[model samples]
Target: MFELIKKKLKHTDGYPYLLSILEHCLQMTYKRNGSQLQQWQLLDRILQQIVLQDEKGEDPDVTALENFNVKNIIKM
Candidate 1:
């Protein structure tokens, strides 16, 4: 599911509701334990952009996050 979302994020103009669905899923993850949802990598990658941006004091940088990994994604 998120694999498709990841792809669509690059071309959201073609998928109007992608962000809405993404937000809903994100809230769901926060409301429950994310480890069992097969969402670790999805959340990990989605979150890496923000974490990197926060740490570096810059706009979210997907390039910087390509190979990054958060040790404990569920706690983030």
Candidate 2:
């Protein structure tokens, strides 16, 4: 990775922002993991609802959360 970065810097007219790439990837990974964690939580909640349905007789909503905007999230 360091050698690739060095080669890119030498071959390009302008230097690529390595720190920016690193930062963006780090943030993107964090966001991806966060989304996965949220999904797991949602699944767990749904399963719990199913398990408790005999006692509580409640139905879980099949709809997803509505407030998350993809464009806004990507801008971050």
Candidate 3:
């Protein structure tokens, strides 16, 4: 098995082309923090909804909380 692997590695056709394709694949490296749905900008909107109901000073529309769907903004 080792001999076969060595032979395949030494004889890879179009190795340069394969390398160029692999290099492109490495470009999309991702960094992540602990924030799920990292929509930091949307934080203010949600906060206003919970803190200040409306311009007329009504109660917060808390029922809409049940309809909140993270999937609507991002896919798993």
Between candidates 2 and 3, the one scoring higher on lDDT is: 3
Task: Show the colliding residue pairs in model 2.
Answer: none
Models 1 onward score TM values of: 0.24, 0.31, 0.25
Please give, for residues 1-76, the per-residue lDDT of candidate 3 as tens digits: 7466456665677456546655754663444653332444244446557576766778566665566765554444
Compute the lDDT of residue 58 as modeled in candidate 2: 58
Model 1 TM-score on a 0 to 1 scale: 0.24
lDDT-sorted candidate list, best first: 1, 3, 2
- Clashing pairs for model 1 are none
Better of 1 and 3 by lDDT: 1
Q: List per-prediction Cα lDDT, in the order shown.
A: 0.60, 0.54, 0.55
Look at candidate 1 and tell me the lDDT of residue 4. Answer: 72
Give me the candidate number with maximum TM-score: 2
Off by over 4 Å in 1: 1-38, 54-61, 64-76
Off by over 4 Å in 2: 1-33, 59-76
